[model samples]
Target: MNELISQAIAQWQLMHSIELVATLLALAYVILALQQSLWCWPAALLSTVLFTHVMWQSALLSDALLQLYYAGMALYGWWRWQQLKQGSAGSRGPVYEWPWQRHCWLIMATAVAGLALGAVMANYTHAEFAYLDAQTTVFSVMATWLVARKLVSNWLYWVVIDAVSIYVYAQKHLYFLTGLFMLYTVIAIAGYFIWRSHYQQQPAVRLSV
Candidate 1:
């Protein structure tokens, strides 16, 4: 076990400086986001920008593109959160649960999108783990949007996405990334329960309003 740890550390040391920075920032983003801190969006933006370069260099085209998407989403999420914090009349209410029917439809949509993108990448590019990449990308896009919308169920989607990402990163010998996603999985679980408690209070908040 020590040897494995040492080797993983050695591998990480050999990785690009930007990758290391991105990993740290990504961790910060997840932690702060879980705490509902406004600072999380900036952390996510920087992390995704660095990761875009990292994934592009690693020849993971889909992931690289996904990082760009994440960067954009970070900005949108920041603005959305700000609006919510300001109590704008047009802004959506507190964290809430999506209906099961909506989640079912989302899952089906994500699968179909992943399959389509995977086929395109497999046929037109040399991208590694095309299907897995697409799966993670599709779900992550939806999950991030859910987070921005303050949906309580977003963390549940992230648990699955992060778990799959661990394998995807491991296959590329990105041990640090694998470790990061593993942490994300655990944090995502914690996020679900945390948000659930907050969600339960929404009814009371509304009643008192």
Candidate 2:
């Protein structure tokens, strides 16, 4: 019993230690991204690198994998944003909104995929809140892509995802992340308005991607 207790305490300390630094970097990523700063990608890359290990240790496989994806997207986002800034893409500005039809299809597809993944994990593995985790992971994947693509509506997607993430992290006793997601939810709302304003100032350019 003493041995188990000691192990648990050590794990808790380690998790919190990592979470603290990851949270700070993640905060930096969000703030910089809000400002359309290219530096956000490097911050996101480092933060997700730490989160991948943390989520894997917590048995959140979907989230762990998502962190890996985020790391890759961070690099891609930086390159793409740099191109946008340089006017290499022939675009007026960095932000654009997807049509309602596209958003509808995206939501339907994401829901189906999330359900399928959740069912597989629930039956074949020991994952906590399998459906919720899978759904959030799927939506986050889409949101992150939209962010990289500089979609104005990405912030709206993140607003919903971050709010849901608060409950998910809380269930795992990751109090720091729970608080971070709470902050994220608020920031995402502000981001939507800020990006929308920027988008409105530009000549509308729609490109199918």
Candidate 3:
């Protein structure tokens, strides 16, 4: 156990400065987002930019591309949240729940897309863990959109994505990133219960409006 701890520490110590910065920013974003704070968008944007560069350097092309998508989504999420705040008298928007049927469709779509991306990357690129990378990337995009829309189920999706991401990063010897995702999994679980409770307490009038 001591030897394993030492190895993990050494790997973490070797992480790039930008990766550390990104991780910190990402943690901040998740915490704020869980609390339904609008400030999370800016933090997410900065973190995604740094993470994009870090993933590219690490040869995780799918993850790098996902980060680029996240950068763009950050802007959209910011604007959308601002609109929600203004429309609702400066309060965070109501949390929403999608129908089970819609989620089933989304899951099917993500799986198909992941398989296609995995096949392309396996055939044409040196990307490692292509299927797993694609799975996380595709689902993460969906989850981010759900978060932007204030969906209560977004945390559920993130729980699965973050858990898988921990393994992916660990396989690449990115101990810092692996640890970050592990924390993300816990945060995602907490976010789910927190949002659910808030949703339950929300005025029916507000939801109808």
Q: What is the C-alpha RMSD of each candidate to the true structure, in Å?
A: 5.8, 2.1, 5.2
Worst 10 residues of 3 by lDDT: 200-209
Rank all candidate structures by their lDDT, best first, as comma-separated numbers.
2, 3, 1
Q: Which ten contiguous residues of candidate 2 have the minimum total lDDT?
A: 87-96
Global lDDT of each model?
A: 0.86, 0.90, 0.88
- lDDT, candidate 1, equals 0.86
lDDT of 2 at 180: 94
- Give the TM-score ranking, best first: 2, 3, 1
Model 3: colliding residue pairs: none
The true-versus-predicted C-alpha distance at residue 80 of model 2, in Å, is 0.8
TM-score (C-alpha) between model 1 and the true structure: 0.88
Best by TM-score: 2
Give the per-residue lDDT of model 1 (tens digit) for 93-178: 46657668878998999999999999999999999999889888888888999988888889999999999899889889877788
lDDT of 3: 0.88
Encode model 3's per-residue lDDT on 1-209: one tens digit a residue.
Answer: 99999998876565567788899999999999998998999999999998997898778989999999999999998998888778774378777776788889989998999999989878899898988898898899889999988888999999999999998899887777888999999999999999999888876533211
Question: lDDT score of model 2?
Answer: 0.90
Number of the top-ranking candidate, with lDDT as the measure: 2
